[model samples]
Target: MTIQQSYKITPIANLLGRSGSSHLLLGLLTVAPTGTLAISDLTGSIALDLQHAKPHVGKDAAWFCPGMIVLIDGVYEEDHNATTSGLGQTGGIGGTIGGKFIGFSIGGPPCERRNVTVGVSDGVKSENGDVTAGAGFGWVDFLGVGSERATGSKLRRTEQRLLGPDGAHTGTAKMVVCGEVNLDSPSTLEALHKMLRSYATDDADRMPMTVVLMGNFVTHAVMAGGNSGSGGSIEYKEYFNALASVLTEYPALLRRTTLVLVPGDKDPWASAFSAGASAVVPKKGVPDIFTSRVKRAFAEANREAGVKKSGVEGEAVFATNPARISLFGPAHEIVLFRDDISSRLRRTAIRFATLSHDLEQGEPVEADATMMSGGLGTDSSTRENTMDVDTPTPAPAAFPSAESADFETLMARKLVRTVLDQSHLSPFPLSTRPVHWDYASALQLYPLPTTLVLADAEAPAFAVTYEGCHVMNPGRLVREGRGNQIGWLEYDVVSKRGVVKEDML
Candidate 1:
């Protein structure tokens, strides 16, 4: 009996991580083979794509070097032609005028070959023709973190692994992500009822290993009412009282599922929050605690109906808005932020193009397509559809003026890429968008994450893989009175790939 079972409890304050009955290994991520070789976060003209027939004696360096964060002292090849599209004016691109090498995109004034070589601050001079005239300014491999993990999240079919307990297979365990469960919308409320009812009847696969629900549960109406009830919307307290009945009716679902909720900025209970404006973790109590009234009411109603106490208190969670999910043994991590930071990013990010598509950092980025800089007047749907070059676009709004309160741009798919590339969630200057000065380190998204859920209402639902991380946005349950909508995210532990989709609730 020396092999007595032992389960490692994660430090997460709320989740099956601590409460599940079965002892389980936690935070386990499959690691790539380790070796010493040069690696860079760069792609364009300078990165030598070293591929060999049987792989060279030293080329066994497979994708993202894991668990290591290194520093590279090489020069940054400044994109000379990089020009921001100023509002109302069409600016010329500053990239190299070229004959087809990727040092830089073809642009700028044509000139005879001038300065053939350049010297670095280190007094290191380049050889003749080593630099692609204006195309590549500097290409050097400096020392960097040489962790032996792959660079991006796309898992080759051969690399898949299971994420649940030790005995679980790769295809068996799944995580459910949904957002904007506005309690005000009857349609949204009904959608939950239907979902629970269906699962109550489903004895086979009703329970997913975990479910995350992001919120604006109180909506603007409740907040404006000062919690007293406004615009004929029911008060916050009444809303939870009613939700109790729904949860009680589907007792089976209450028993099986672990529900985790994170609050959104617009959520009624969150209005008075003054901690960190851009921070995702809720400053108040956990989101599920709001539903405690429902549990209490359920118990009372059951006794009144001449029924036995269901003994179901609903194993629910109240977690920070941007809580962290850890799998220690696998070394896998997931960070969930429920607010719509995508909207803020579009407002202040320094940009090159209107991101036609989500950038897959692991693979080559397709760049031949022209990006139309839709100004402040842009809407989410317009940004989503702008990639279809053939689509006729209306004039983009005037360039945004930060000082002017009326100005705010809404860039679509590009927002996520900008955030990932910067390795920070709220990339705008702190003055532009302040984060909690004390907890700022909490938002540093370095080494990236195995999965990042950006549940936003301003952006469409999308799943994009960037720098060995999965970035997903599950929009909202209801938009503009149209209810019965849901966003879904599915991640396969073995492959490190996630599938994201949105549909009728």
Candidate 2:
């Protein structure tokens, strides 16, 4: 969405809860094919209505903040660029069409009507900014040590607090977060084993609090076909058996160190896997290995090796793709998300070409791609898809300079800016992007965490603290089977201070 097309519509209230099995008069809000929104009451208290109203202020529809709470004058329409003159109505599902909604009105006070653009000085404020939430235990050093509190912050849904809890910091030792490791390969497994053993050989007291291993644990064949057949299950069993055997070998590490395994797009036993869709999953773990035959195999292997595995049960933890790790009662919170969001943002972003003349004379690059709004009959809502310019951006003619360097880096920073600015994990259209409707809150950056670790398969590992939230992408363990890059964050449990490092594996 562009700045010129930005409009304002205030919200009234949001849907509270579920509908009961009673004859309830519900207001149904449906998006039609003509890019329009329609609101119809099932009880017939009001006639079928339709209207052309957009609740989104900025050109981008995802610019909504959590505190922008207002129910629509009619019903809320979730769309890309859909619209209508009045409102279209749909039937009730199980005697309830629409349960509740947050109302909105464009015909409100003159002061209420405001246009907001990304990175603009003037904009709507999110009521739930990360202010008071910072007073918790670990929230002080959440942006590392000696960072000022964010004021007049653009992202309103962020946590609002400047001080830490009225207690001492209790930081964990250190955490090693490595990106996608395909345990399907013997060489990869051996490499992981060596890495774990090296930590043990280094120092006894220098133990890591946790080793977060993001997944793609199995081979491509297993991920695509699944572990159903005899051979497939055996492959899985053997892989896990090797993993269990490695754990028994490192008793000291297992006892003190927690192993957090987050599943990837192809990882098995995740809620997203069962859903058979690649929506962002909720916070959960792998299928219980204790109840499965793998548990028996682990025990048998341990018994044969003369290794007692008692505390190892609680050591291994399965986490969601986008998960959080809170330490010392929210004194320090760590958020980890394993996704290709960087690439998604890069491709979907408005592409631009730096003109040859501009580069030669040192002028700012400008975007020339024409922005499209709407076209059709009686304005009805249609799915708003991500717009991409078919005309590829022209290659720059000039060499590198300090000024050009900033422009070059903007491509990467743009991704982080878009995500944080929108207060959404993935701001793409719902039709193309999949998110658990019920678990949508999982993507919200409300009360932003102390640290955000975005593990991606892209190059050039980077880190930036946004709105007192440390955002870092550790890159990947294996990118296209090229090489490995792992990340380690040294966190002091007592001082509440930490340093991030990305190393090649």
Candidate 3:
């Protein structure tokens, strides 16, 4: 089949505008007979040349094919250096450049070598303009490139062997559900229950379910009067315990389920506080404790289901059958089974065959010495290829002082705050105002499958899957102004249902 296509190209002058036009260059070429394909920029700003070599003696020749290529070139000048008060103050610039060419190659098979070169020169600038010229050349052997693509040997040998034979239950299913619930409000819980019921009753074939909880689950409680110490209130403890009890009763409902939790800022423990120690403790530390306690409750439930130990140390746990369920927590901590569900289901079998036919008439099957010419002799060639193999590397140990690591810890905490703040600032209106959670607050349970839960009790239960892994903040309900008026509950289909392939982009 032959396919030819072309389109008008537009370059974006401004990065911030919606109408800014930018084009991505991508091409694919397969030539049966060795040939050359050249794409020269009609605008004279870029050029691409590709060629394939003829067969060498009795061996196959090298072929050139690129999956993608991108080139960009333009003149730019910063106006800030100018002394003029008009356009210079607004960061404007004026310049003219001669010719510039840039190119990149991607996804070429083995036995091929690819080169990318950029050239820039000849430029004129205004009085205050700053200019620079540059050129570069890069060559890459397609046989051993980077981590993204697998070589033929690795794919055929190692991967094939690892897959081995197919087993029963090879078919897989995935379901993602996300939604928001008000931790302080009982009615919100009712809404969550309704959502969960809908998912529970849905047909698995059409909408395989995996649950993801994003955003805030609880309002933090504000501390008042004497209850201001590191220790949380007995009421707070009872509240979470009760919530755990409720969740445990629905264990059967979650058979084969995966849960993910992302905490929000309204969660009381996201703030900063004094830990009786000489150092300052983060408010988030409290919610983390609560999350740990809640996880423990889940572990207890799992044990009831015959699991001897809880897989609380990582984002995934292995069942008696060795089935895995991965968990991803706040700050993007991902826990997953070694064998990914989708990959397992999509495995394909690959095999190669050699075709031979008897030569016409009395043609000899064996070659003689007389057939040799120019250092090239004809004889049946035997190709010896290695089969499947696996090389394992030792897992790295965790940092000894991660708990006290200043830069990474601070960056992580800041990132958490930024995400929550951005979510809160989203244009979507909240049904109720957010409430602050405090040490002794009681949080009502919203019955969504992956409802993000947070707590304010400073020393709430918490756990990190691994050293350097992000800590989890258990779900909690914040105490509003005494009367228990629940804060806002916003329902989002994206959050309620886990991220989908399309949603990822």
Candidate 4:
């Protein structure tokens, strides 16, 4: 008759008591193919001794694959100050038996283990007992190093530094997560889970959090090394999937977490080749073993959460909330996404535009034209030939009959005298005095809607005849003149005539 045997599994708490005085043993009786042993505190600290414990079988005696004995210890305190020593006892085997023997040590005053041994036995008295010891201790420092007084003093100093005499608040927080996560190890996962839980509970109100994630996250498949070569690894999709699974499992802790990914120089894509030979590279076929994966993971998460993403070039800004959020790449370039301040700028621009438009539409304003006629006076023989025949005759000549013969003769003689007096001015016949006065009378002021006048003379000295108005010299002061200047004369607007003041003449 053939029969099948079954074995009973036991929790480590059932074998070990709550205090630090118990011997927890497994694989000593009714050995099976494989099994696990754990010891934990239900309320307080629990410790055990396993110096005399032995595996069920001898070296080279294999029922199937090898089996192992696991030990776990749990404690709680304000600070870590416990010691774990000689917890694991592997007998006469090199590799893992009953799967790998795992030791879980959690919580307490930070503990340190010493004089632990591990490896294979070679049938000598001392050497045979020297198989690899799989035992290690892990603990948390409940209360940190500094005293309460010291902490308060540091906090006060920091506040004083950040907020000066004006008492303005300015503070920033920076968080750094260095090193890699071992996804394959269950024990490592459990330890990480506990650490994250503690962090979430302790630091929840911290704002403007700056997180810098560094180092190689994904491990190479064949080489199993850090920052080695690229390629020959699972694609990023699979990697992201695994990461998503882990994150989803811990949603309560990571729901509002903001992560920034910075790629290391030794990342996989940064390398030229993987093996000693040249191989064609595959796209999306190998996982990115760098910080790019972290960014991609965040992007996917944001998308799944229905966050809006928008940007230009390779840079992007995400508005997961009303708060402004911007993400950049590669660390070499910095991109800033901010609110528009153009509304303030538009006011100034509008003022300038209005001035320009008014200037363009209005008629041109005229300036005073000061004529310095060099060829104004000469002898009649020299002057008549130079003067154009079509030019208007002088007013004195045209109204010669109005003056008596004696007066005309006297004026002609006086004009001849004035011509000879100012002869040194220019050789041109028109520059003569009598001829100059003739040309000056025929001059007409151009009509303009607006005109500006600036003059050093005291007053205008001539009469202006235009448009049926015989405008007489009004003897007005040029300094307070309202009308524009017509040549050397200051023309009055109301009087419509160029007048010379007594002082100027």
Candidate 5:
């Protein structure tokens, strides 16, 4: 969102007397007990009139939910003609401030790129026209990949040496991401076997650096029969045993690539307890007890290769539902989350009336593709591998060819904007999308990462770039109507590109 000029924020309390005067206010939007839209701040709460309000960004660019804190520009009107006390007149403490705030424009705060927030960006411009340098947490190592100031330069040099024009084009910088790997499904297992075998055929140097397998892992909830004595636990363990057999057949792939296992809502423990219901995030990974056989397979492979069983050559990682993977120090940060966020957003979103014709005079925001391609005015290479720079290479064939106004494109934009602007994974109310309070910080997207793998089976398989952050959803492993073909995404770290690929069974 672009700022035309500086505006001072007016407290809700100050609006008590200043009727008919325009003021900018920052507050959390909420639904009052009366079922009317209201904005609340520590100062007070005020009813809002947004019947004709236009979002500073485009109308359909974002999903407006009640829990979001936003900037609202409008005028205040007093309720002098009312018969009874409007809000704070004769009511108790924490009563509503007088009258309705007439909103003209509203939008969430602009998101900061990871580079700019870490003081590593090459002089990116802020809304105030000042160079944002040495701002934010430049000293912290959120991902344990050395502090930005200490190891940033060294890792950048290494990145250039490996991915630049003069560098080697080894496929080590690429990552393979596959989602919804239901272990009990024979078709899913066949697809997984084919994909791994195909990757195993790659020459040693060209092997993918990391292969991420997101899970439902079973057709139904694990431990659904209840208790350890029930058949649910036994069935769940057998699935892993079957997976171990698959891994044992491809020891070379196991020895060469890091396999990251991220659990989905239907995975064990949580799934067992939730009884096929939506579980709170960020959920714990599949329990170690159920994955012992898979670990043994990796150990056996490492031993056969004559390498330290625990060395970095290759191994399986059981990661939390929402996890971060950092490579090349602070250069690349990829967040992996498995959930049905799109459906949830649609279900809980606040439906705004269609944008009025008079409001059409407002400036239209650029499309996501345009905004992603240098809209932020930062050169790509200097901004920690953002796709801002124009490359001669063609976009992957599977990249969506639909126009900006396409329904899928619009939904993708709305989802991306809502998530990125809020800087939170699940932006709905806690009741709608429960978050683990203690680990809530793990779900923040602040200093937005370079890539986001949101394994949402309900949403279409899409790769969308917005505000320099690339979000991709591989969807389910098998497309129902597409001849049972398997689909997944291949993300290239150096090029900052992701392509969806499908293979026939």
Candidate 6:
């Protein structure tokens, strides 16, 4: 059912009275005591049959994990077999509803935008001030920038004054993000230097406000027992020292822009313990223990430039792997995550086989090898023959030209949808994508951010926009064999648009 439909979520306890009638319900999808799937809410639980259930959005199958909260549209049959137990058996919610719910369609709850949730807009506050300010989480500062209700309006006005087209400094609100920088690789450092110098040439007023450098700073697992890994944690510290040297050269850039360092799975601490294996989500940032030299470089640069507002003073921030950057409070939020999520998702993805649309339409259904490799291959032969049968429900203006989307483009679209629709960075089970239970809240994308910087070196570098949220990947900073060329992303915070850029030496 569409959002516009007027519907009430029938409580599980109330299901028995409305037997054989269709109704909508909101509950958690879980396994019952009998090992069968069930849905449960506070009132009680009922057995669920989703074998033939389709996603509410027919074009794409909504991801359904056991712990996910979902909306189900189905009919309740009181006479259906009770071999599958209901959730009431496992919890103290209530007695079993004694019915089977045959689902028609299922989907994630509709996402809320920042403006609506924060009451940041003049119109929103004027119309629903009492409700939004009191009920919404607008008073909580998720990123520690400032509470949305408290500073959202003031920051927004400042944002327009500084970033709006009619304002004075329009182009200065830009961010430069580089994907993977292996400090051990001289070429990568040289390429980064070139990128820095290129930006440093811009007038002071036109400089980017932030420069994000994501990691895997070393060429290989620093903790692995080998010649390369011999240095271990100490060697890892030296790599940052080398990077510090690079930053010292461009003191002007360091003094002007905020340097955000986001660690990768292969970065220290976690790497030292996990041996570069799949680390937990919301992993700690590169420990201050190693980033001291990098911090020193920033301090030296600041001292060279003299005192200024602490907010404008250039400083290096070692942010958590999955970090949120709030600019203009709730007006804009940028999420930075460095992981090969595209690869992990495909490895654990549920592959379903159904008749292709082409076959149903009596058209040729050609199977290409590229479709099997997670749509990363860009060979013309593969692109021409492969059909994007699995493309997510196309957005009205998101793709613009759906038929012409290549495998890489299709992959980007799939990645964006799966992450945003679920409203969680890691939607897979704990086994597939381990998340720190306590910090799991950090991974939630509720009221989705304005932009997501998914610096996945494994995923093809491409920018995709879905449902007003823009996701970009810089891919591998310097692909092997592609000498002296570096790929990165330039995002215009004012316009909320990103352009993939490459610098060639």
Among the numbered candidates, top lDDT falls to: 5
Q: Is candidate 3 or candidate 6 better by lDDT?
A: 6
* CA lDDT, every model vs. true structure: 0.42, 0.44, 0.26, 0.25, 0.74, 0.71
lDDT of 6 at 114: 51
Superposed model 3: Cα runs more than 4 Å off: 1-147, 150-172, 197-209, 220-239, 272-286, 308-505
- Cα error, candidate 6, residue 343 (Å): 2.5
lDDT of 4 by residue, 226-301 (tens): 3443333454334444544554443323434554332221223432343211111111112334234434545555
Instruction: List TM-score per model, in order.
Output: 0.50, 0.54, 0.30, 0.22, 0.84, 0.78
Query: Comparing candidate 5 with candidate 6, which one achieves the higher lDDT?
Result: 5
Look at candidate 6 and tell me the lDDT of residue 332. 87
Q: Across residues 401-447, which tens digit of lDDT does each residue of candidate 2 receive?
A: 22333532433343443455445575555554667778777776654
TM-score of 1: 0.50
Worst 10 residues of 3 by lDDT: 383-392
- Model 5 regions lying over 4 Å from their true place: 1-5, 54-57, 81-95, 122-134, 161-167, 225-231, 308-312, 354-405
Best candidate according to TM-score:
5
Put down candidate 3 lDDT per residue, 198-292, tens digits, no spaces: 44543433222345443334333323232433224444444445445545555533443445543333323432231111111112223444555
Residue-level lDDT for 125 in candidate 4: 28
Backbone clashes (count) for model 1: 37
Backbone clash total, candidate 2:
52
- Those runs of model 1 whose alpha carbons end farther than 4 Å from true positions after fitting are 1-172, 197-201, 204-206, 221-234, 273-282, 287-289, 294-314, 328-330, 350-413, 479-485, 492-495, 501-505
Off by over 4 Å in 4: 1-172, 182-191, 219-231, 235-237, 250-255, 262-266, 271-505
Give the count of colliding residue pairs in each prediction.
37, 52, 34, 31, 0, 0
